[model samples]
Target chain A: MKTHLQNGQVIDDSVPQGDNEAVAGKVVSGSVIHIQNLRKEYASVAGVVPVLHGLNMEVMPGEFVAIMGASGSGKSTLMNILGCLDIATSGSYFLKGRDVTALDRDSLAHLRNDLIGFVFQGFNLLPRASLLDNVALPLVYSKVSREERVVRASDMLSKVGLAKYRDSRPNQISGGQQQRVAIARALVNRPKLLLADEPTGNLDSHTSHEIMNLFKELNERDGITIVLITHEVEVAAYAHRLVRLADGHIVYDGSSHIPQGDNEGTMSKNSTESSAAAHSTS
Target chain B: MISAMLNEAWNSMWANRLRTILTMLGMVIGVSAVIVMQAVGQGAQQQVRESIESMGSNLLMVLSGSSTSGGGVRFGAGGIPTLTIGDAESIGELPLIAGAAPTVNETAQVIYGARNWSTQITGTAPSYFTVRNWDIAEGAPFTDSDLRSVTRVSILGKTVVDNLFGDENPVGKTIRIKNSPYIVLGVLSAKGQSLMGRDQDDVILIPITTAQRKLASSQVVGSVRFIMVQVRSAEVMSKAEQSIVDLLRQRHRIREGANNDFTVSNLTAMANTAAETTAVMSLMLGIIASISLLVGGIGIMNIMLVSVTERTREIGIRMAIGARGRDIMLQFLLEAIIISIFGCLIGVILGIGGALAANGVTGIRVEITLSSILLAFTVAAAVGVFFGWYPARQAARLRPIDALRFQ
Candidate 1:
């Protein structure tokens, strides 16, 4: 299947075109993420539970994409693989043209630090650290000098308009402000890709829009590639393209403006019934 | 990276002030216990060593053998008058022997004008001072002429001088012993206490001839109680002892395979045994204190494990933000080390203070050596690393997904 971008670019999943160097499993040069035949599984007492089955996708540089899925749809698993937080059981996943599956644990960590930034749903700031230190946390692992780390982290904090609260801890701020701090931290290292997993899940609708607007501004103004995960249609509406997952498969992959009632109806119905079943069994 | 981790560790510890201090309490108690116990034990050992040195080096005591009475009742060693001034003189001439003094001691009442005290009176030649390493603090010791002329001259110990003279200089003053007036020749310096806990300074010395003729007139002439012999050095102590034994046996005309009339005892050997016992006691105290250090280490491990579990979410967040396993491990490990080292610092201060207080209150000698402080620090640091390893590894080995999922 071919997924077309708003900027007149096409992501062909079948065969990558020119600049695809086949030197020892190297892929097309310009794609930020290129995954082919990706699969993941967990071994349980009963049997093997497969979460992703030979999923193929590509994300070009500077594109904003949102992944939407019901509960148990394996979207979280795919996001984890893209973020380099987990290794696929069997797959050829190249992040920034380097085969991620072939890298060791430390090398993968370096790649994540250099290439991708993560914003979790919980706005996971180190509660004990000041906001400046929280934003500077990634640079600590990146071997940045202390002076430079503070400079860069404060610059990012000011960009997110939380400059005055640099010395404030996470608990001292409101929920929207905390998410803004999380965004500041995510952008501090100048990573090429921002992988936000349900970044606004904990906020009310008004605050969620504020955080979503911050993500949109970071994507458009700084040209940072963003792949956000969420089940909320309004949150996904900000992204130019959408990938919807159902039962470990991408049921719809197209423009985000497609009527949500038809797509979300089956997804939300499946989630509600499954949740009801889970509740009754428990 | 290390500095940043240290800062992070410090912040976390500061955030959990109560828990950090509670964790450090174990190490503090352990290190202080080690220091105080070592001080006390080393102080005891030093006291034993000083007492040993004060008795004179390489000394041997030759005591007269026990005597069997009419009904086969045996008197103990040194009960008979077999060791005499003649035997002591002959022993002094031996090649390995440094000097020998025939000594006879008895309790007697000493009287000065308006003051009188009962004290031990030792009768011996002037060589007794050199043989026993007794120094004269003031005036001059009596000479050989005094011994030969049977002069009624005496040397007073510090304790005796304090009692009889008060503030007066006893030298050239007359003191009455058994109603006979004797001129005080000199005063001996202070010798604190003997190994047997006897007051070495509470004595008076008189000429052996004067003592034999005037004081103990009922005894045989030239007979003495025991002979104090000094060897040249520690190396020839056994040789000198054997030579004295053989010479005494031959002099007393004891037959082959028969016990001699006198027994030679090595004082150095007895001192060595006492020193060894104290050394063993010191070592035992150190070991006992080290057990508390072991408990402290275990306490660190226990608290670290709990910390790792509690901070799993933080570890997950750090890992998500590109922290490697080693980074997480180092963070936790640094926290443990900081706690222990700070605890050690406080413990050293408290231990030294406690040792000084013990010395002040109990009047015990306490030594707080630099080596012991260094030892406590190193052990505390080593304990921190050793116990922190497993919990740190447990935190590091956590999967990012699993850790993030931990509540």
Candidate 2:
């Protein structure tokens, strides 16, 4: 039996009754998010075509998962729903034991503020403002006092190695430097879940690897949940687990054995979905 | 929030310093015109009042004709022929009238030494100084004895003294009036020019008996030019005028309700007319100046709209960062108002300079009233508020996602 939480996500309240219980049940916890039978579709002149089809996923309290898919494989669609940027058409989504699928846009925004931090591919910085101002923007919306917001934003920028550029405009910096500032801005509000969609898309491969390393350090040290979306298999390899989607369905979900510290190699030749499944069982 | 808004406004203004300065030019010129025009108008009114006061209130000038050569009826010609030495004597009997004098004037040439000067000669009784509000600055005026004896004695005005005597004293000296010798009794005080630009102190005054006996042609005491009446106080002048007009009209056998050949204008009426004309002119100038203020406001609006377009991406980023629409609106609106208010402040300084320039160019006393300055500033602020609102609203209503994608 599934019970609906106030956030509109369904909680699977049934306790396991041995091996048979692991078959179809998706367990949702008191401090985590769970998704089951999640579907999203777009109604175009070509009729209703599904973007996400009967997908199932779970996020633990401190799990760092990366999603890998091609451009049209529905990875971003799933990330948007997970980050509360959009709502799923038919799904049971649970966040911290509360159902969140039925909440309105305002409530969803509230939840995103309280629970999610998003880093976009474009590093959406206000071009004319200082880096400190960009980092303090979210806190400004949350009604933080001016003095406190400045102090916090400065500290966050310094931690992200952007302290020297705190007063500089976005146009005065390189792409990697801008992305570092974006990362500092994302962390300023200290949200529980960091949803980064192609967070290093505009950076060089070396900068991308450095950014992934920073993400890994943040996840391990702060125990914050991290969900990264990327088409590059090498970028995804930095995560502890991988969810591969194809034709709007998760073709594989398992522990990924990436080259332990190979920052320069693409992990695409590591194995196929079938081989990964065989390796997981062995 | 207010600090952020101000920063936004101030920075935006400096973003295009040349455009902002150019826009302020319209307001500066407009405000200056209004202030200068008002000051000059006020100065003109004051000059008229001073001229009237200098002419004195006691003198009543009467002409025989009802109209000037220009075809407009002269104001005080109604009781002219009937107002003679007899009416003057009668008016002297009134309680409010302290004295009355009959006058006769003629234009003639007076030869002294080898120089010939064309002068206006006035004949009047010995009491002319008292009734006409004139004073002697040198020697003495013609006395009662001179009037009784029909003495050929005269008092010279400043212009006559300057021409006939130069630096020498003219008192007790002999001068020719129409080929007849007359003793110069005194030199009158210098009264400046009148509103018509004519010299008020140009003519010479002689005893009425001398003017009648020496300069008269072939007729009886034809007509006294005017009866100059003097009263105890300015407060009683109106009463004195009414009494004289009533006595003269009755003596001339004029009916009631007819347009009297003569008119009476008091100092108060003349002053009031001058003031009214000045007020009307200032009001018209103020309206014209207000048009420039409107144009300044339009300039602000146009610039603000352009600013909104240029900052769309910034606005989107702010919205994405959790700023509400109202917050964005306030930021832009505040900027526009700040720019306009700054313009107004500078315009006020320019307005003061304009008023001073007008005063220097034309010797007019322009008084800038506090209310006028305040009104101008209030209109400026209102222009800022009114025109700045639309562009601010446009910035605030932009969708976050669309704004960020504007590229």
Candidate 3:
């Protein structure tokens, strides 16, 4: 029998357990997200191609979740849905105890603006605006007063160790510093969920380690739930929980405290259908 | 919120200063053209009005014949000698007649102190000066006794005095006209030029009785060139003109529909025609100049499209920050408005400066009215809203995902 992990407990894979009750029963309050049977498809010239097939996931407040998959494993599509940038084909998504699937585009945008902060792989800062202005951008949509916006933005920049460079533009800073600014911008609105897609994708390994450490620190001290997508094991090593997707289904969802060498073996065995994931990670 | 949008718009424009300036130039030139055209038109009309006003508003001229030239071979209104002094005296007796002058214009060579000059010599009663809105600058005008006695007294115009007497006063001096010595009575004030381009001050005034009896013997004794009549009141001018025409036709024994032997032209009618024509011409020029503003608006639209495409990534960034479509639209719309308002301000300065320069350089009259400036500015703002909406809409419609992925 396959030994699968649920809520940090080893269970038999033959049990056919419903994961929603297991996660919801564990954390009664502060349940940030609850999704069941989430399916996503794209209309291709050939036909409708499914990317996520009946995916079920649950994330409690303040938990750092790292989602790992190779290029065709639908990791980016999953991040898009979780960030409210997209909708699923047919599924129920309750974010912060509100039915997100029933919301319209504008309401979804409002929810995204209010409850989620997005960090892209590219550190997409408006090139012409100063770091202070960039960090205050989300508050502009929220109609925050100028004095409050500046104060809150400056406070976030100080947390990222970029307070001195608030007046400087994005291009004037280094790549690592730009990502730090992006992080500051993400946290300026005090979003409950921080969604970062390969936040350190363009950085060197040393800088990526520094950035991931910052994520861990923020998750621990501030109790901010973070979900990051990455294809690199080293980048994913920072998260407490690891969820691996293969062929549009979750192959493994467990604590990532297992040895690194053991992960290579499990990847090769579990994602045999997608040899790309095993080879890319190894 | 608006302040935030404005600040963003200002920063984006500052990023491409040269392109912004180039775009502004189109509207500047457009608005300036409109103002200059309107100024010149208004100035020309004002000049026409001043000239017409100097001719005495209620005055009427009784020419010897109709204005239409027979068979299209044009003849001056004074070509026929059909009017007589009797016609003038009868017109003067009417209830509406304030005064009458039978004027005869003939060029004469005058000599004074070996300096001789040829100028127009007008012979009429003293009322001619009043009817023509002329004030005597030196000695008094010749009286009716001077007209009946066929006296050799003459009133010299300012130009004639300047040329003939230089700085000296010629009131008591003698000037020779056709070798007949005449005493200078008064010097007329400068009247500049008439609407017909005739020099009003380059002439002399003498009695009509003397002109008929002394200068040209071939001219009949009873006939005069034309009759200048000033109506007692403006309200009675049309009635005055009608009664005079009827009396003239009766004296000349003309039957009904038999084309009267004379024409009566009133100053108000002539002034209205000239003023209307000038106003219409100005409106036409104003309309033509405004077309350039439309072209400027198109220029704004074209440049904004390029800006929208160039800043696709920025649009995506803003959208990701939870900006609604209207927010993106407002940013661009504000940008276009700033350009338009800036363009209008510069154009107004240039337009007023150009009008003044035109007055100095080309000597063309140009009036800069407050209303035209306001009108031009309002139109420029409207142009901003009109041309700006499309490009702003295009930006607003962009999907955040697609825009971020754009290179």
Candidate 4:
């Protein structure tokens, strides 16, 4: 698909769905937002320095993208803006293809709650609450009925393969299991965007891979859009595409070299491997 | 959301268990102090009331000789001389007067078979028993005939009986009193101890006529020393006292400006005084006890502040997870209240137990008034809210990004 930028310059890309339809020179194809000329500045004793400098971004519906960066690369600031935890100092940001840069605090909070599911690096599970209760927390905040919340929370837990451990405290579970619980908690309200900030940063290599695999599974199986921030290349490999940021702007956006064995590919690969095993036995 | 906030608070409190407990300690002491002090105070008051009741509530004590200038009889040092047997006779004539008894008292050391008891000896009218609410546990009082004939006979108090007769009944036996043999007439009933720590039943009672004729031998009984009178009912006591005071004042010819020599004390007034005094004491005690509750509240405040600091990271996490400032604030605040209420519950149990134990040891009555318990619980809950607010606010105001970023 070819779309013209604001400068009437032609840009070519494959449109995934109707979410990428053009609107005032900005792509809007079921994509809720198009970030253009986004900028963030921090004032210290030294003076104002920008953290996000004219950053261009697009979030399409049902697309899992990872933003990877080295330390102090302003990925966190970008994630904050995306999650509405903080507002960008100056930006042309459209949410659901509608401008949300002018929204008030209450509106922003409502938007964050309605659309965003944040999974932190530390899991951020309330240590004293049972897994089901933790998962049911967002529904509680939204004033969902007790019975409905319980049913939904249980379903979410079962989806994460933690149905049996629903009554256990977060501390009683393994680190990977806790992250899975956090994922369940985040997804309970069925938020439109899963915003995970270095979700596997605190885990070991094997657990980190397991978490990444689970994220990939959730993105593929449930079709939930995920925007993950990470420093690790291995962690970013599970996503369909990786966007690398340096300083305050995107330096790279492409598929990583590593092939993530998704469900359909795994099934086909498994069939081939099993045939090879059968032939060898014969 | 409220419940989630509560859960957040509970978790934080549980995480810092020691600090939380220390915080609750101030409240515990404050609650216990208020409760226990009031209890002890009530108990002591009850004890005094009971003692006064046992002393006969409507009885009036009348002493002779006024301290006025123009009295014919000089009552030895600063004494009242208005009261006399003739005045007792007039008081007895009143319909409201139930009984009247004239008395002459002397402290004596009596010896019997190698045992000695130092006690008061009283020469009294036959109506003394009725007037003083005294019953003869064994034997009888001297009759009117015994009094008219000047017969030497005596009845002993319990202490005197125990000292002189042991377990044996000494009625109809002859006992020596002041080198004169007087027949044992009766033993007075047990009246416990007096307010001044004197044994109430330690005295000996004899016929007033016989005491005057046989021992002191003067028609003028020194200064009309003592009289114990009882009214027909407690309601008529004030009227009876006023009437007697009026009669004595007229007979003594005291001027209006002069301080009356004789002091007439009704047991009812004495009882009221005692009760009032005890109530004041209990109030002081209650105030002191409340100090512990204050201390416990401070403890809770201290722990809550520490908790606010300790859970800064967790608070940040919740704020990031779509929690508002109010949510975080309420969570910690709820935790603070819960701890105080817990301490209050425990302290109430301890206070009641302590008060009951004190009552047991002191033989005093303790009434755990509902108001006291309710007041304690309210104060404790208030302490929680008051002390917890600052910390909760601090937690709520914490920026989510900042908190999560806290190492």
What digit string (tens of lDDT, one per residue) describes model 4 on residues A236-274? 667776666666756555454323344432422442322
lDDT of 3 by residue, B1-407 (tens): 89999999899889999999989998998899989998999998887887787777788999987674345454467777789887888888888898788988899899999799999998888878877778999988999999889999999988899899999989989999999999999998887767776778899999999998898656677688899999988889899999998999899998886776688889778877888999999999888889988888898999899999998888887777688778899999999999989998999999999999999999998999999999998998799778988999999888776777789
- Where does model 4 sit among the CAPRI classes? acceptable
If the candidates were sorted by their lDDT against the true structure, best first, what order would they fall in? 1, 3, 4, 2
Q: Give the whole-model CA lDDT for all candidates, comma-separated.
A: 0.85, 0.73, 0.84, 0.75
1 versus 4: better TM-score goes to: 1
Q: What are the per-residue Cα lDDT tens digits for candidate 4 across B307-344? A: 77877887766666566777677777889888988888
Q: Tens digits of per-residue lDDT for model 2 on A182-282?
A: 88887888887888989988889999988999899999998878888987777877887767776676665655444333442545555654334323432
- The interface root-mean-square deviation of each model, in the order shown, is 0.9, 2.9, 1.2, 2.1
* B356-399: candidate 1 lDDT, tens digit per residue: 99999999889889999999889988998999999999999998
Worst 10 residues of 2 chain A by lDDT: A2-11
TM-score of each: 0.92, 0.70, 0.87, 0.73
RMSD to the true structure for each prediction, in A, is 4.0, 7.7, 4.3, 9.1
Candidate 1 or 2, higher TM-score? 1
Candidate 1 B-chain TM-score: 0.94
How do all the candidates rank in terms of TM-score, highest first? 1, 3, 4, 2
Candidate order, DockQ descending: 1, 3, 4, 2
Candidates 1 onward: DockQ, in order: 0.71, 0.24, 0.56, 0.29
The segments of candidate 3 whose C-alpha lies over 4 angstroms from its true place after superposition are A1-29, A36-54, A88-90, A101-109, A246-252, A257-282, B66-76, B95-100, B110-118, B133-141, B153-191, B229-242, B255-259
Tens digit of per-residue lDDT, candidate 1, span A8-81: 23233234433332322647678888887788898999899988776667788888899877788788999999
